[model samples]
Target: MTRRCGFAAVIGAPNAGKSTLTNRLVGAKVSIVTQKVQTTRFPVRGVALADEAQIVLVDTPGIFQPRRRLDRAMVRSAWGGAEDADAVVHLVDAPAQLGDSPADRRAQADVETIIAGLKASGKAAILALNKVDAVKREALLGVSAALYETGAYDEAFMISASTGSGVDDLKAKLAERMPEGEWLYPEDQTADLPARLLAAEITREKLYLRVHEELPYSAAVETTAFQERKDGGVRIEQTIYVERESQRPIILGKGGQTLKWIGQKSREDLSVILDRPVHLFLHVTVDERWADKRAFYGDLGLDYDA
Candidate 1:
Protein backbone atom coordinates (compact mmCIF):
# COMPACT_ATOMS: atom_id res chain seq x y z
CA MET A 1 0.00 0.00 0.00
CA THR A 2 1.26 3.49 -0.84
CA ARG A 3 1.72 5.94 2.06
CA ARG A 4 0.60 9.56 2.02
CA CYS A 5 1.48 12.51 4.25
CA GLY A 6 0.77 16.23 4.26
CA PHE A 7 0.24 19.22 6.55
CA ALA A 8 -3.29 20.47 7.27
CA ALA A 9 -3.54 23.85 8.98
CA VAL A 10 -6.59 24.42 11.18
CA ILE A 11 -7.35 28.12 11.53
CA GLY A 12 -10.23 29.80 13.32
CA ALA A 13 -11.34 32.47 15.74
CA PRO A 14 -10.80 32.05 19.43
CA ASN A 15 -12.89 29.39 21.20
CA ALA A 16 -14.01 27.81 17.92
CA GLY A 17 -13.08 24.29 19.11
CA LYS A 18 -10.00 24.04 16.86
CA SER A 19 -7.97 22.43 19.62
CA THR A 20 -10.75 19.99 20.43
CA LEU A 21 -11.13 19.01 16.78
CA THR A 22 -7.37 18.50 16.44
CA ASN A 23 -7.32 16.32 19.54
CA ARG A 24 -10.24 14.29 18.25
CA LEU A 25 -8.67 13.78 14.84
CA VAL A 26 -5.28 12.89 16.34
CA GLY A 27 -7.05 10.65 18.86
CA ALA A 28 -5.19 12.28 21.78
CA LYS A 29 -4.84 15.53 23.72
CA VAL A 30 -1.86 17.05 21.90
CA SER A 31 -3.23 20.60 22.18
CA ILE A 32 -4.69 22.16 25.31
CA VAL A 33 -8.38 23.09 25.46
CA THR A 34 -9.90 25.73 27.75
CA GLN A 35 -13.00 27.88 28.00
CA LYS A 36 -10.95 31.04 27.63
CA VAL A 37 -10.09 32.35 24.20
CA GLN A 38 -6.48 32.40 22.88
CA THR A 39 -5.49 29.53 25.10
CA THR A 40 -3.35 28.20 22.30
CA ARG A 41 -0.27 30.40 21.86
CA PHE A 42 1.53 28.54 19.07
CA PRO A 43 1.13 25.97 16.35
CA VAL A 44 0.87 22.47 17.85
CA ARG A 45 1.54 19.74 15.31
CA GLY A 46 -0.44 16.56 15.91
CA VAL A 47 -0.08 13.48 13.69
CA ALA A 48 -3.20 11.52 12.77
CA LEU A 49 -3.04 8.18 11.00
CA ALA A 50 -5.82 7.62 8.45
CA ASP A 51 -5.04 4.19 6.98
CA GLU A 52 -1.95 4.81 4.80
CA ALA A 53 -2.14 8.58 5.05
CA GLN A 54 -0.51 10.73 7.76
CA ILE A 55 -2.41 13.93 8.37
CA VAL A 56 -0.10 16.42 10.12
CA LEU A 57 -2.52 18.72 11.93
CA VAL A 58 -1.12 22.19 12.54
CA ASP A 59 -3.31 23.59 15.29
CA THR A 60 -2.62 27.31 15.00
CA PRO A 61 -3.41 30.15 17.36
CA GLY A 62 -6.79 31.85 17.02
CA ILE A 63 -6.84 34.76 14.57
CA PHE A 64 -8.04 37.99 16.11
CA GLN A 65 -7.58 41.74 15.85
CA PRO A 66 -4.10 42.53 17.12
CA ARG A 67 -3.76 45.03 19.99
CA ARG A 68 -0.27 44.15 21.20
CA ARG A 69 2.98 42.65 20.00
CA LEU A 70 2.09 39.24 21.39
CA ASP A 71 -1.30 39.33 19.70
CA ARG A 72 0.27 40.38 16.40
CA ALA A 73 2.82 37.59 16.62
CA MET A 74 0.09 35.07 17.37
CA VAL A 75 -2.00 36.22 14.43
CA ARG A 76 1.04 36.13 12.18
CA SER A 77 1.86 32.61 13.31
CA ALA A 78 -1.73 31.55 12.49
CA TRP A 79 -1.55 32.88 8.94
CA GLY A 80 1.93 31.47 8.50
CA GLY A 81 0.61 28.03 9.35
CA ALA A 82 -2.12 28.32 6.72
CA GLU A 83 0.30 29.62 4.10
CA ASP A 84 2.62 26.63 4.53
CA ALA A 85 0.07 23.83 4.69
CA ASP A 86 -1.08 21.64 1.80
CA ALA A 87 -4.68 21.91 3.05
CA VAL A 88 -6.45 24.39 5.32
CA VAL A 89 -9.48 23.94 7.58
CA HIS A 90 -11.26 27.10 8.66
CA LEU A 91 -13.26 26.18 11.75
CA VAL A 92 -16.08 28.49 12.84
CA ASP A 93 -18.17 28.55 15.99
CA ALA A 94 -21.71 28.27 14.62
CA PRO A 95 -23.71 29.29 17.69
CA ALA A 96 -21.42 32.20 18.48
CA GLN A 97 -21.68 33.59 14.97
CA LEU A 98 -25.45 33.40 15.10
CA GLY A 99 -25.74 35.10 18.50
CA ASP A 100 -25.89 38.83 19.33
CA SER A 101 -23.76 39.10 22.46
CA PRO A 102 -20.62 41.28 22.44
CA ALA A 103 -18.37 38.23 22.52
CA ASP A 104 -20.44 36.62 19.80
CA ARG A 105 -20.08 39.74 17.67
CA ARG A 106 -16.36 39.69 18.15
CA ALA A 107 -16.27 36.04 17.18
CA GLN A 108 -18.26 36.72 14.05
CA ALA A 109 -16.00 39.61 13.19
CA ASP A 110 -12.94 37.40 13.60
CA VAL A 111 -14.47 34.84 11.27
CA GLU A 112 -14.95 37.54 8.67
CA THR A 113 -11.34 38.62 9.10
CA ILE A 114 -10.25 35.03 8.47
CA ILE A 115 -12.36 34.82 5.35
CA ALA A 116 -10.91 38.07 4.09
CA GLY A 117 -7.43 36.84 4.82
CA LEU A 118 -8.09 33.71 2.80
CA LYS A 119 -9.40 35.80 -0.06
CA ALA A 120 -6.35 38.06 0.09
CA SER A 121 -4.15 35.01 -0.05
CA GLY A 122 -6.15 33.61 -2.95
CA LYS A 123 -6.47 30.31 -1.14
CA ALA A 124 -9.62 28.25 -0.79
CA ALA A 125 -10.17 26.37 2.47
CA ILE A 126 -12.50 23.67 3.74
CA LEU A 127 -14.98 25.29 6.11
CA ALA A 128 -15.86 23.37 9.24
CA LEU A 129 -18.78 24.79 11.25
CA ASN A 130 -18.02 23.77 14.81
CA LYS A 131 -20.49 23.35 17.70
CA VAL A 132 -23.31 22.56 15.28
CA ASP A 133 -25.22 20.80 18.03
CA ALA A 134 -25.64 24.14 19.76
CA VAL A 135 -27.46 25.66 16.77
CA LYS A 136 -30.48 24.69 14.71
CA ARG A 137 -29.97 23.01 11.36
CA GLU A 138 -31.74 25.91 9.61
CA ALA A 139 -29.41 28.45 11.23
CA LEU A 140 -26.40 26.29 10.36
CA LEU A 141 -27.50 26.13 6.73
CA GLY A 142 -27.91 29.89 6.65
CA VAL A 143 -24.48 30.43 8.16
CA SER A 144 -22.99 27.87 5.80
CA ALA A 145 -24.59 29.51 2.79
CA ALA A 146 -23.37 32.97 3.72
CA LEU A 147 -19.81 31.75 4.21
CA TYR A 148 -19.84 29.63 1.08
CA GLU A 149 -21.01 32.64 -0.89
CA THR A 150 -17.80 34.39 0.09
CA GLY A 151 -16.00 32.04 -2.32
CA ALA A 152 -13.27 31.46 0.24
CA TYR A 153 -14.30 27.91 0.95
CA ASP A 154 -14.44 24.93 -1.40
CA GLU A 155 -16.36 22.58 0.94
CA ALA A 156 -18.37 22.88 4.15
CA PHE A 157 -18.95 20.50 7.04
CA MET A 158 -21.17 20.89 10.10
CA ILE A 159 -19.49 19.24 13.04
CA SER A 160 -19.74 19.15 16.83
CA ALA A 161 -16.14 18.74 17.94
CA SER A 162 -17.04 18.10 21.56
CA THR A 163 -19.33 15.17 20.77
CA GLY A 164 -17.32 13.66 17.88
CA SER A 165 -20.13 14.33 15.43
CA GLY A 166 -19.10 14.38 11.74
CA VAL A 167 -15.44 14.36 12.75
CA ASP A 168 -14.52 11.09 11.07
CA ASP A 169 -15.85 12.38 7.77
CA LEU A 170 -13.72 15.53 8.02
CA LYS A 171 -10.67 13.47 8.92
CA ALA A 172 -11.21 11.21 5.94
CA LYS A 173 -11.51 14.18 3.62
CA LEU A 174 -8.22 15.59 4.89
CA ALA A 175 -6.57 12.21 4.46
CA GLU A 176 -7.77 11.94 0.87
CA ARG A 177 -6.17 15.30 0.09
CA MET A 178 -2.73 14.26 1.31
CA PRO A 179 -0.14 13.67 -1.42
CA GLU A 180 1.59 10.34 -1.71
CA GLY A 181 4.81 10.22 0.34
CA GLU A 182 6.55 8.35 3.13
CA TRP A 183 5.25 9.00 6.63
CA LEU A 184 7.12 11.82 8.40
CA TYR A 185 6.88 10.27 11.87
CA PRO A 186 6.67 6.89 13.54
CA GLU A 187 3.23 5.31 13.62
CA ASP A 188 2.96 5.66 17.39
CA GLN A 189 4.08 9.29 17.59
CA THR A 190 1.10 11.60 17.97
CA ALA A 191 2.90 14.94 18.39
CA ASP A 192 6.27 16.50 17.50
CA LEU A 193 6.60 18.93 20.43
CA PRO A 194 9.69 18.63 22.61
CA ALA A 195 9.15 17.13 26.06
CA ARG A 196 10.10 20.36 27.83
CA LEU A 197 7.78 22.42 25.67
CA LEU A 198 4.94 19.94 26.10
CA ALA A 199 5.45 19.98 29.86
CA ALA A 200 5.32 23.78 29.90
CA GLU A 201 2.19 23.73 27.75
CA ILE A 202 0.48 21.31 30.13
CA THR A 203 1.36 23.44 33.12
CA ARG A 204 0.22 26.55 31.29
CA GLU A 205 -3.13 24.89 30.56
CA LYS A 206 -3.61 24.14 34.26
CA LEU A 207 -2.62 27.69 35.13
CA TYR A 208 -5.19 29.10 32.73
CA LEU A 209 -7.89 26.79 34.01
CA ARG A 210 -7.25 27.91 37.57
CA VAL A 211 -7.03 31.66 37.05
CA HIS A 212 -8.42 32.47 33.65
CA GLU A 213 -10.37 35.44 35.00
CA GLU A 214 -7.69 36.79 37.32
CA LEU A 215 -4.69 36.45 35.05
CA PRO A 216 -4.52 37.94 31.60
CA TYR A 217 -2.47 36.52 28.70
CA SER A 218 0.70 37.85 30.36
CA ALA A 219 1.35 34.71 32.32
CA ALA A 220 3.73 32.11 30.82
CA VAL A 221 5.06 28.74 31.93
CA GLU A 222 8.55 27.41 31.18
CA THR A 223 10.03 24.09 32.14
CA THR A 224 13.37 24.79 33.78
CA ALA A 225 14.48 21.18 33.98
CA PHE A 226 13.33 17.63 33.37
CA GLN A 227 15.38 14.85 34.89
CA GLU A 228 14.94 11.09 34.92
CA ARG A 229 15.50 9.56 38.32
CA LYS A 230 16.78 6.11 39.21
CA ASP A 231 13.30 4.89 40.17
CA GLY A 232 12.10 5.32 36.57
CA GLY A 233 10.41 8.60 37.48
CA VAL A 234 10.85 12.16 36.25
CA ARG A 235 11.37 15.40 38.13
CA ILE A 236 10.18 18.49 36.30
CA GLU A 237 10.66 22.05 37.50
CA GLN A 238 8.77 24.95 35.95
CA THR A 239 8.39 28.66 36.58
CA ILE A 240 5.17 30.57 36.02
CA TYR A 241 5.69 34.22 35.04
CA VAL A 242 3.19 36.98 35.72
CA GLU A 243 3.46 40.55 34.45
CA ARG A 244 2.75 42.33 37.72
CA GLU A 245 3.65 41.79 41.31
CA SER A 246 0.05 42.31 42.31
CA GLN A 247 -0.99 39.40 40.09
CA ARG A 248 1.26 37.10 42.09
CA PRO A 249 -1.29 36.72 44.85
CA ILE A 250 -3.90 35.48 42.41
CA ILE A 251 -1.70 32.61 41.26
CA LEU A 252 -0.27 31.81 44.67
CA GLY A 253 -3.66 32.06 46.38
CA LYS A 254 -4.16 32.26 50.16
CA GLY A 255 -1.61 29.98 51.81
CA GLY A 256 -0.36 29.04 48.36
CA GLN A 257 -3.36 26.80 47.72
CA THR A 258 -4.06 27.90 44.17
CA LEU A 259 -0.57 27.23 42.90
CA LYS A 260 -0.56 23.95 44.76
CA TRP A 261 -3.76 22.85 43.09
CA ILE A 262 -2.44 23.79 39.66
CA GLY A 263 0.77 21.87 40.24
CA GLN A 264 -1.09 18.81 41.54
CA LYS A 265 -3.52 18.71 38.62
CA SER A 266 -0.71 19.22 36.09
CA ARG A 267 1.43 16.51 37.67
CA GLU A 268 -1.43 14.03 37.61
CA ASP A 269 -2.11 14.61 33.92
CA LEU A 270 1.59 14.61 33.02
CA SER A 271 2.12 11.31 34.82
CA VAL A 272 -0.69 9.68 32.91
CA ILE A 273 0.42 11.10 29.57
CA LEU A 274 4.08 10.27 30.11
CA ASP A 275 3.28 6.84 31.61
CA ARG A 276 5.74 7.51 34.41
CA PRO A 277 5.67 8.92 37.90
CA VAL A 278 6.30 12.68 37.88
CA HIS A 279 7.50 15.01 40.59
CA LEU A 280 6.42 18.41 39.42
CA PHE A 281 7.68 21.61 40.99
CA LEU A 282 6.14 24.99 40.23
CA HIS A 283 7.35 28.51 41.07
CA VAL A 284 5.86 31.93 40.44
CA THR A 285 7.81 35.01 39.31
CA VAL A 286 6.86 38.52 38.30
CA ASP A 287 8.23 39.35 34.86
CA GLU A 288 6.70 42.45 33.42
CA ARG A 289 8.31 41.98 30.00
CA TRP A 290 8.38 38.28 29.33
CA ALA A 291 6.09 38.65 26.34
CA ASP A 292 8.41 41.24 24.85
CA LYS A 293 11.44 39.01 25.17
CA ARG A 294 12.84 37.57 21.95
CA ALA A 295 13.63 34.24 23.59
CA PHE A 296 9.98 33.76 24.45
CA TYR A 297 8.90 34.10 20.82
CA GLY A 298 11.71 31.82 19.68
CA ASP A 299 10.59 29.19 22.16
CA LEU A 300 7.01 29.30 20.88
CA GLY A 301 8.00 29.40 17.16
CA LEU A 302 6.35 32.81 16.73
CA ASP A 303 7.74 35.80 14.88
CA TYR A 304 8.66 38.19 17.67
CA ASP A 305 9.16 41.11 15.27
CA ALA A 306 5.68 40.68 13.87
Candidate 2:
Protein backbone atom coordinates (compact mmCIF):
# COMPACT_ATOMS: atom_id res chain seq x y z
CA MET A 1 0.00 0.00 0.00
CA THR A 2 1.20 3.51 -0.73
CA ARG A 3 1.71 5.98 2.08
CA ARG A 4 -0.74 8.85 2.44
CA CYS A 5 0.02 12.16 4.09
CA GLY A 6 -1.18 15.76 4.15
CA PHE A 7 -2.16 18.68 6.36
CA ALA A 8 -5.62 19.04 7.88
CA ALA A 9 -6.11 22.39 9.54
CA VAL A 10 -8.68 22.08 12.35
CA ILE A 11 -10.18 25.56 12.56
CA GLY A 12 -13.05 26.75 14.75
CA ALA A 13 -14.22 29.23 17.35
CA PRO A 14 -13.06 29.42 20.96
CA ASN A 15 -14.23 26.58 23.24
CA ALA A 16 -15.17 24.56 20.18
CA GLY A 17 -13.10 21.55 21.26
CA LYS A 18 -10.84 21.88 18.20
CA SER A 19 -7.83 21.49 20.46
CA THR A 20 -9.41 18.51 22.17
CA LEU A 21 -10.17 16.91 18.81
CA THR A 22 -6.65 17.56 17.58
CA ASN A 23 -5.19 16.07 20.73
CA ARG A 24 -7.40 13.00 20.33
CA LEU A 25 -6.54 12.48 16.67
CA VAL A 26 -2.86 12.95 17.51
CA GLY A 27 -3.17 10.78 20.67
CA ALA A 28 -1.50 13.49 22.76
CA LYS A 29 -2.05 17.04 23.83
CA VAL A 30 -0.31 19.60 21.66
CA SER A 31 -2.62 22.60 21.78
CA ILE A 32 -3.75 23.85 25.14
CA VAL A 33 -7.43 23.46 26.13
CA THR A 34 -9.19 25.91 28.41
CA GLN A 35 -12.65 27.06 29.38
CA LYS A 36 -11.93 30.72 28.83
CA VAL A 37 -12.46 32.34 25.46
CA GLN A 38 -9.50 32.93 23.13
CA THR A 39 -7.25 30.42 24.85
CA THR A 40 -5.22 29.42 21.80
CA ARG A 41 -3.21 32.42 20.69
CA PHE A 42 -1.41 30.73 17.74
CA PRO A 43 -1.29 27.69 15.54
CA VAL A 44 -0.07 24.41 17.06
CA ARG A 45 0.49 21.56 14.64
CA GLY A 46 -0.16 18.06 15.93
CA VAL A 47 0.69 15.04 13.76
CA ALA A 48 -1.76 12.14 13.63
CA LEU A 49 -0.33 8.89 12.27
CA ALA A 50 -2.99 6.36 11.30
CA ASP A 51 -1.87 3.19 9.55
CA GLU A 52 -0.37 4.42 6.25
CA ALA A 53 -1.66 7.98 6.61
CA GLN A 54 0.04 10.92 8.30
CA ILE A 55 -2.34 13.81 8.93
CA VAL A 56 -0.48 16.91 10.05
CA LEU A 57 -3.21 18.62 12.02
CA VAL A 58 -2.74 22.35 12.29
CA ASP A 59 -4.71 23.34 15.40
CA THR A 60 -5.33 27.02 14.88
CA PRO A 61 -6.51 29.63 17.34
CA GLY A 62 -10.23 30.19 17.77
CA ILE A 63 -11.64 32.76 15.34
CA PHE A 64 -13.42 35.67 16.99
CA GLN A 65 -13.94 39.39 16.65
CA PRO A 66 -10.52 40.99 16.74
CA ARG A 67 -10.41 43.73 19.32
CA ARG A 68 -6.66 44.04 19.71
CA ARG A 69 -3.44 43.50 17.82
CA LEU A 70 -3.01 40.07 19.40
CA ASP A 71 -6.53 39.01 18.41
CA ARG A 72 -6.11 40.13 14.80
CA ALA A 73 -2.88 38.18 14.50
CA MET A 74 -4.42 35.09 16.05
CA VAL A 75 -7.49 35.27 13.83
CA ARG A 76 -5.26 35.72 10.78
CA SER A 77 -3.27 32.65 11.74
CA ALA A 78 -6.48 30.62 12.13
CA TRP A 79 -7.68 31.35 8.60
CA GLY A 80 -4.16 30.97 7.29
CA GLY A 81 -4.20 27.41 8.60
CA ALA A 82 -7.29 26.61 6.55
CA GLU A 83 -6.08 28.37 3.39
CA ASP A 84 -2.92 26.26 3.27
CA ALA A 85 -4.31 22.87 4.20
CA ASP A 86 -5.15 19.87 2.03
CA ALA A 87 -8.24 19.40 4.18
CA VAL A 88 -10.04 21.58 6.70
CA VAL A 89 -12.12 20.47 9.67
CA HIS A 90 -14.42 23.13 11.07
CA LEU A 91 -15.13 21.67 14.51
CA VAL A 92 -18.34 23.16 15.92
CA ASP A 93 -19.51 22.81 19.49
CA ALA A 94 -22.91 21.24 18.95
CA PRO A 95 -24.16 21.82 22.50
CA ALA A 96 -23.44 25.50 22.26
CA GLN A 97 -25.33 25.69 19.00
CA LEU A 98 -28.35 24.00 20.56
CA GLY A 99 -28.52 25.93 23.84
CA ASP A 100 -30.59 29.10 24.00
CA SER A 101 -27.98 31.23 25.73
CA PRO A 102 -26.08 34.28 24.57
CA ALA A 103 -22.85 32.24 24.55
CA ASP A 104 -24.52 29.70 22.31
CA ARG A 105 -25.58 32.38 19.87
CA ARG A 106 -22.05 33.74 19.84
CA ALA A 107 -20.76 30.28 18.96
CA GLN A 108 -23.27 30.10 16.09
CA ALA A 109 -22.01 33.42 14.77
CA ASP A 110 -18.42 32.19 14.79
CA VAL A 111 -19.37 29.10 12.82
CA GLU A 112 -21.11 31.31 10.30
CA THR A 113 -17.98 33.41 10.02
CA ILE A 114 -16.05 30.27 9.13
CA ILE A 115 -18.66 29.30 6.57
CA ALA A 116 -18.38 32.74 5.05
CA GLY A 117 -14.63 32.46 4.85
CA LEU A 118 -14.94 29.06 3.16
CA LYS A 119 -17.41 30.44 0.65
CA ALA A 120 -15.22 33.46 -0.11
CA SER A 121 -12.24 31.22 -0.73
CA GLY A 122 -14.24 28.60 -2.63
CA LYS A 123 -13.07 26.02 -0.11
CA ALA A 124 -15.09 23.00 0.94
CA ALA A 125 -14.53 21.78 4.48
CA ILE A 126 -15.18 18.61 6.48
CA LEU A 127 -17.66 19.78 9.10
CA ALA A 128 -17.29 18.05 12.47
CA LEU A 129 -20.08 18.71 14.97
CA ASN A 130 -18.13 18.12 18.15
CA LYS A 131 -19.17 17.74 21.81
CA VAL A 132 -22.08 15.50 20.89
CA ASP A 133 -21.70 13.74 24.19
CA ALA A 134 -23.21 16.75 25.90
CA VAL A 135 -25.92 17.40 23.34
CA LYS A 136 -29.04 15.48 22.35
CA ARG A 137 -29.27 13.68 19.03
CA GLU A 138 -31.96 16.05 17.75
CA ALA A 139 -29.83 19.08 18.53
CA LEU A 140 -26.91 17.57 16.66
CA LEU A 141 -29.20 17.07 13.67
CA GLY A 142 -29.99 20.76 13.76
CA VAL A 143 -26.31 21.68 13.73
CA SER A 144 -25.67 19.21 10.95
CA ALA A 145 -28.56 20.73 8.97
CA ALA A 146 -27.32 24.28 9.35
CA LEU A 147 -23.82 23.35 8.22
CA TYR A 148 -25.07 21.16 5.41
CA GLU A 149 -27.39 23.89 4.17
CA THR A 150 -24.46 26.28 3.90
CA GLY A 151 -22.93 23.87 1.36
CA ALA A 152 -19.52 24.73 2.83
CA TYR A 153 -18.64 21.16 3.79
CA ASP A 154 -17.86 18.18 1.62
CA GLU A 155 -18.38 15.73 4.50
CA ALA A 156 -19.45 15.75 8.13
CA PHE A 157 -18.75 13.88 11.36
CA MET A 158 -20.38 13.94 14.79
CA ILE A 159 -17.78 13.35 17.48
CA SER A 160 -17.06 13.62 21.18
CA ALA A 161 -13.47 14.71 21.45
CA SER A 162 -13.20 14.22 25.21
CA THR A 163 -14.91 10.85 25.33
CA GLY A 164 -13.41 9.34 22.16
CA SER A 165 -16.88 8.63 20.83
CA GLY A 166 -17.09 8.44 17.05
CA VAL A 167 -13.49 9.59 16.99
CA ASP A 168 -12.08 6.48 15.32
CA ASP A 169 -14.63 6.84 12.54
CA LEU A 170 -13.70 10.49 12.14
CA LYS A 171 -10.03 9.58 12.05
CA ALA A 172 -10.66 6.96 9.39
CA LYS A 173 -12.53 9.47 7.28
CA LEU A 174 -9.85 12.12 7.76
CA ALA A 175 -7.18 9.60 6.83
CA GLU A 176 -9.07 8.49 3.75
CA ARG A 177 -9.21 12.09 2.57
CA MET A 178 -5.41 12.37 2.55
CA PRO A 179 -3.74 12.61 -0.83
CA GLU A 180 -1.14 10.03 -1.73
CA GLY A 181 2.33 11.32 -0.90
CA GLU A 182 5.30 10.84 1.37
CA TRP A 183 4.89 11.74 5.01
CA LEU A 184 5.67 15.35 5.84
CA TYR A 185 6.90 14.43 9.32
CA PRO A 186 8.26 11.39 11.07
CA GLU A 187 5.57 8.95 12.17
CA ASP A 188 6.80 8.96 15.73
CA GLN A 189 6.63 12.73 16.10
CA THR A 190 3.29 13.66 17.65
CA ALA A 191 3.34 17.45 17.74
CA ASP A 192 5.25 20.35 16.18
CA LEU A 193 5.11 22.58 19.28
CA PRO A 194 8.39 23.34 21.06
CA ALA A 195 8.85 22.36 24.70
CA ARG A 196 9.07 25.95 25.87
CA LEU A 197 5.79 26.85 24.23
CA LEU A 198 4.07 23.75 25.57
CA ALA A 199 5.33 24.54 29.04
CA ALA A 200 4.05 28.06 28.83
CA GLU A 201 0.72 26.76 27.53
CA ILE A 202 0.37 24.34 30.43
CA THR A 203 0.80 27.17 32.89
CA ARG A 204 -1.64 29.26 30.95
CA GLU A 205 -4.15 26.41 31.06
CA LYS A 206 -3.94 26.33 34.85
CA LEU A 207 -4.29 30.08 34.96
CA TYR A 208 -7.45 30.01 32.89
CA LEU A 209 -8.84 27.15 34.93
CA ARG A 210 -8.15 28.77 38.30
CA VAL A 211 -8.35 32.49 37.63
CA HIS A 212 -11.23 34.59 36.45
CA GLU A 213 -12.28 37.52 34.26
CA GLU A 214 -9.48 39.81 33.06
CA LEU A 215 -6.47 38.28 34.80
CA PRO A 216 -6.02 35.23 32.60
CA TYR A 217 -6.44 37.28 29.45
CA SER A 218 -4.17 40.03 30.73
CA ALA A 219 -1.39 37.53 31.58
CA ALA A 220 1.00 35.28 29.69
CA VAL A 221 3.69 32.85 30.81
CA GLU A 222 7.05 32.13 29.18
CA THR A 223 9.59 29.47 30.05
CA THR A 224 12.83 31.26 30.89
CA ALA A 225 14.85 28.26 32.05
CA PHE A 226 14.82 24.50 31.43
CA GLN A 227 17.54 22.25 32.77
CA GLU A 228 18.11 18.52 33.14
CA ARG A 229 19.06 17.13 36.52
CA LYS A 230 21.81 14.49 36.76
CA ASP A 231 19.16 12.11 38.14
CA GLY A 232 17.30 12.20 34.83
CA GLY A 233 14.65 14.67 35.96
CA VAL A 234 13.87 18.14 34.58
CA ARG A 235 13.59 21.58 36.18
CA ILE A 236 11.63 24.40 34.57
CA GLU A 237 11.50 28.10 35.46
CA GLN A 238 8.77 30.33 34.03
CA THR A 239 7.80 33.96 34.49
CA ILE A 240 4.11 34.89 34.42
CA TYR A 241 3.58 38.41 33.11
CA VAL A 242 0.48 40.40 33.94
CA GLU A 243 -0.72 43.79 32.75
CA ARG A 244 -1.05 45.43 36.16
CA GLU A 245 0.37 45.41 39.69
CA SER A 246 -3.11 45.17 41.11
CA GLN A 247 -3.60 41.96 39.11
CA ARG A 248 -0.31 40.61 40.47
CA PRO A 249 -1.76 40.31 43.94
CA ILE A 250 -4.81 38.59 42.49
CA ILE A 251 -2.63 36.00 40.82
CA LEU A 252 -0.39 35.70 43.86
CA GLY A 253 -3.33 35.61 46.31
CA LYS A 254 -3.23 36.76 49.94
CA GLY A 255 -0.27 34.67 51.13
CA GLY A 256 1.09 33.83 47.71
CA GLN A 257 -1.45 31.00 47.62
CA THR A 258 -2.69 31.26 44.05
CA LEU A 259 0.79 31.20 42.58
CA LYS A 260 1.63 28.08 44.54
CA TRP A 261 -1.53 26.38 43.31
CA ILE A 262 -0.67 27.23 39.75
CA GLY A 263 2.86 25.89 40.20
CA GLN A 264 1.61 22.62 41.67
CA LYS A 265 -0.92 22.04 38.90
CA SER A 266 1.56 22.84 36.15
CA ARG A 267 4.21 20.61 37.69
CA GLU A 268 1.74 17.74 37.98
CA ASP A 269 0.80 18.01 34.33
CA LEU A 270 4.45 18.26 33.23
CA SER A 271 5.37 15.19 35.23
CA VAL A 272 2.62 13.16 33.62
CA ILE A 273 3.39 14.34 30.08
CA LEU A 274 7.19 13.88 30.38
CA ASP A 275 6.76 10.54 32.23
CA ARG A 276 9.30 11.75 34.75
CA PRO A 277 9.28 13.87 37.87
CA VAL A 278 9.29 17.58 37.16
CA HIS A 279 10.25 20.57 39.30
CA LEU A 280 8.41 23.70 38.20
CA PHE A 281 9.19 27.21 39.38
CA LEU A 282 6.72 29.98 38.66
CA HIS A 283 7.18 33.70 39.37
CA VAL A 284 4.65 36.44 38.77
CA THR A 285 5.64 39.80 37.26
CA VAL A 286 3.85 42.77 35.75
CA ASP A 287 4.50 43.56 32.11
CA GLU A 288 1.62 45.79 31.17
CA ARG A 289 2.25 45.90 27.44
CA TRP A 290 3.48 42.39 26.67
CA ALA A 291 0.39 41.71 24.60
CA ASP A 292 0.92 44.85 22.54
CA LYS A 293 4.61 44.26 21.72
CA ARG A 294 5.78 42.39 18.63
CA ALA A 295 8.83 40.80 20.26
CA PHE A 296 6.79 38.97 22.85
CA TYR A 297 4.36 37.45 20.32
CA GLY A 298 7.27 36.67 18.01
CA ASP A 299 8.78 34.51 20.73
CA LEU A 300 5.65 32.32 20.51
CA GLY A 301 5.91 32.30 16.70
CA LEU A 302 3.06 34.81 16.43
CA ASP A 303 3.19 38.33 15.06
CA TYR A 304 1.92 40.81 17.61
CA ASP A 305 0.51 43.18 15.03
CA ALA A 306 -1.64 41.71 12.31
Top of the candidates by TM-score: 1
Candidate 2 per-residue C-alpha lDDT over 1-306 given as tens digits, one digit per residue, 9 for 90 to 100: 899999999999898998889999999878788878878888899999889999999999999878888888899999998999989998988888877799988988888888999999998998888888887788678779877998898898888999999889888888998999999887678888788788899999998888866565788998999898999899999999988888888888879988899899999998887778898999988888888877787887776667
Alpha carbon lDDT at 54, candidate 1 = 100
Q: Flag clash pairs in model 1.
A: none
What is the lDDT of every predicted structure here? 0.95, 0.87
Pairs with backbone N, CA or C atoms under 3 Å apart (clashes), candidate 2: none
User: Per-residue lDDT for 104-130 in model 1, tens only?
Assistant: 999999999999999999989999999
Off by over 4 Å in 2: 213-216
Residue 255 displacement (Å), model 2 = 2.0
Error of 2 at 34 (Å): 1.7
Q: Report residue 131 deviation for candidate 2 (angstroms).
A: 1.7
TM-score of each: 0.98, 0.94
